[model samples]
Target: MTVRRPIQRFYTEPAPMNKLGKPHLQVVRSISVGQAPNIPDTDGVNEMLAKAGPSATLKDVARGILDRLVERPELEVQVEEILFLKDCLGASLEWLCSLAASDGAACFKRPLLWSGWCSRCDCEAKDYLMIYTKQVNANSCPGTPGSRSRTPSVAFSRPPSWESLDANILEDFDKWDFDSFQLSEATKGSPLHFAGWKALGGFLGEEPSDVFLEMERTSRFLEAVEDMYARQDTVLYHNNVHAADVTQCVHALLLQFGFAAYFDQLSILALLLGAIVHDMGHDGRTNSYHANVCDDIALTYNDISVLENMHISKTFKLMHSDPSTNILEGFKLEHRNRLRKEMVEVVLGTDMSSHFGNVADFKTLIEKLGSDPAEWHHEPKAMSALRVMVLHAMDISNPAKVLPLSDKWSDLLRQEFFLQGDEEKRLGLPISPLCDRETVRFASSQVGFFTIIVQPTFTLMAELQHRVKDVLLTHLQTNTEAWEARKRKEQLGLEISQALPLLKIRPLESTELTDLAVFPDTGACLFSPSRGGSTRDVPCDSQSHGQPRVPAVQRNVEDVEGSDDETALAALAALACCASVEAQVAKGFHKNRPAAPAEAFALFY
Candidate 1:
């Protein structure tokens, strides 16, 4: 049977020299020529090209062509023509020279050609093409006598071995200082990339070559993640550092809890990858905020785990667009499909809305296992549940960390919330609770969150893993205590401010105390002048009489007594003594001076 191959029809026209003084071939129009029976599915190929757009550079076209050729090897001739045209258009020889230099022995090897449709434009408009020398042994290269081909420096040369990632290291995850393992020079300020690469490579037990390849791919992916996040309107709480923290936590959980045994290499890969990209492309806003405002992402996901869905979709889209960063490119079709499904579900589970549900599911799974580790170990459903639950736990595990780390994350989260609150206020929207800086009490909110959400979750996890119970519970207890102490201090300060008036009193000018009358109803002090011996009233309201009414001080004292705070009592006592001495001095002065007319009387200090 004669099968027709897919044809890409392109209407090419001569264009003026580009800025680089090179002849440019403008693609006027493009259309799909035809589909060949022998051709494989070209959707992935087309998608990659489309991402590059219609006005792609020669380098872009070359990459697209190579990607398509990897999937469909039957389109050689058409690809050759595209390459020839690219060369005629003054395509740089730098890439070819670099390849030749690197493959010193294979410089004279016969060039391999491949062709496919340019997925960006209509099938007829642009053809994908590339030409490369076949792989050859470096030892066979005819270089200068005695000259040697330099070997490329390998990242993760001393990656952690699977055997070393056992219980001890897993338990040390909380104590692990990720920055200490960073290759600052290689990662270019992205220590997390190196850390993730080491952890992933170690967990998979990959050989040096395989580990190096995967590391390169993962590094590229991490770079892409960094770039995507850099472009996002993200806050400090959901940035790259937080994502890396979560990823490390997830890795630790898998190893620490012995959950690594249940997951295959592919599953572990997906879990680690999911953790790294779970919060990608965050817009520094909550899902509720997005849904309430009808944001584009909310509408796209129909308000169903909007932020999570966006993160997963954006991550996958980025992976598909860039071959260098497509870490799953080597996976089999079924493995890749499973990876995508697992990654999506796990990442979505990171959303706080699903937290309770995940915890509930974990509990149910544990109940089903019923003290039998053997039964749970091989059960796929249980393992899957554990996988997601672990990720969920890690996502909210900031409070489960040691004091200093926990405090840092808490402050960052509060800052993000306050920023959102400011925006809401500006937009005339009702601010969300724990977001409004004017009203939200940070210590109180954290206390409630720990008591209500974090403590219970970690407690459940601890119950499942008796060995880790102390570690989890200890941190939770310390953090709870810290917040509680803060709450109490804040309350005490508030009471002290209210009680200040109790100690501020004015002394009566007359030595005779029998006429002293306190009017509780009117909060006034009645005094009789020594000269006329007539009673006169002074209001305690500071605004009205330039002096506080005596009744307000009594009220403040009553409040202080009701509080039953020893500190408050001591403060009140000291203030009362000061007030008594001032009054005595004033009375002595008034008695020493002759009594004046009532109209001329003045209140003493």
Candidate 2:
């Protein structure tokens, strides 16, 4: 061998190798004793961390070292070390650490580290000399030497938190709706004095001072409204909050896309105020309740839209209870009646079982508007029609939400309805279809209900308005599929181990069904999958009905006694007719009436 000259290793002028072969493997040395140990390789990053201390995690150490080096120009580390620092301090590292830890600590404390660096020069520099290298210049000198000149205007700019910014859109107005705001002592003197008054502020429309004062005076009216909503048993499903949402939606419709000009300030005020006060006197009973027990409200307005008419009247009664609570404070008598009528029409339009002739009529007006844009503004027909449709749509719009938000509302309504269903059971009343306490999965029922009532109504509206169809369709399909999948899972009766990955389903809630429709307060649901989609009243089969079955409530009302009184009366009449005809045939006196006049008189008597 040609005496390979002991392959000498090069060193920078300042660094000194150990004259005694090499330093001991375990010996501690000051950082200043050598050229920072050749700026540490990627492996050296981990080794450096281990050497630094036992308490620091790989992430903590790596990020700490790089951040220190980056901030201080005097400090330097190899590109490999920088890359190791980035790997150790990345979101993946935090996520992994989070998954391993019993409590998520790393994710909560996300630390920043360098992400970009060069590798070829870093490896070459580390091998050539036992010294670390900072970023190289074009000519390979360390730090700022032999590199492109830094421009006078060059500056580092902070990057935005893109993920955080994107998440804000969903949360912007979630908690700002009518369902959230309630009156407290702090809000007593504001323009939101009544139950959900802040949500009603838009209804004031160009009359801010009047609205504020009206709110102040009518603060006490909340007691009655709350009492109506918070009844002990039976589902008084429609409450003041729901009422407020309708009013708010109408206000938005009027303000955002002002309807026919005829519905001036007076029309807007009437529509909004009526929407709030419409469902006031609901007794948690159905048509029977309207026709029987709470008949005063029905009789007051005749049999037409009985329950809705009652609620409208009760709302007025609350206002008349106290002079201060009266909303017609400054209005003329004629103006007050006109406002009252407008309010009545809007309120009565929300009855699910009530006639939708008004809705049909309103649609006609809208169609007419489509034909003549010039005649659309300020037309009495269009104003009335638009007002009714808007209120109706809002009452049924909860199901038209994106799943996350829609599911939330659904859950809340479900809880409320279940509580009501429990009360109905206690009171010996029939449980409504959607309100059945034993409903295992509400999601499927929701899908069916959506198919029947909610979707069709919205589809019709979307067809006419030509706005929000995409959002509406997306919501419809999502909810439908979600509910259908849930039902299928329940029907299959499979546990988690048996559950197919594709069949994962969400549990049902009371709110989900109500979100689809006003949960029928009574137990007589018109739709059931078990009955092959028929509205027929039949016995519920727990086994065939899937896991959670709707429990039947015993009706307190009278039942029809089949063929008792009417059947007996009809039989007696038939017997008499048969006997008379037989007597005529047996005597053979068909044409001898002249001779037997006295006998015929006796038979007649």
- Taking every candidate in turn, the Cα RMSD to the unseen true structure, in Å, is 21.6, 26.8
User: TM-score for all predictions?
Assistant: 0.56, 0.45
lDDT of 1 by residue, 1-605 (tens): 99896333344544444333333334232243221111111333334434544454434444554555556666543423232233312212222222211100111111111111112221112122111223223343333322323232223232223223333333333342332222332344454554465345332211122112344566577778866663213566887667767877766665555455455555667778888888888877898888778879989999999999999999889978888777776566886798799898889888888878878877787777864344675787776776687677878888877888888888888999999888888888779888898767688789999998888787777766664567767888999999997776555444444444544555543563324433232233333333332114334455435553332121222323233234333433333333333655333333433332223111121
What lDDT score goes with residue 77 in model 1? 31
Give per-candidate clash totals: 10, 12
The true-versus-predicted C-alpha distance at residue 405 of model 2, in Å, is 3.5
Q: After superposition, how far is residue 412 of candidate 2 from its true place, in Å?
A: 4.4
lDDT of 2 by residue, 551-575 (tens): 2113211121122222222222222
- Candidate 2 error regions (>4 Å): 1-196, 199-215, 218-228, 231-237, 256-262, 281-285, 288-304, 355-359, 371-374, 377-382, 412-431, 439-441, 470-473, 493-605
Whole-model lDDT per candidate: 0.54, 0.43
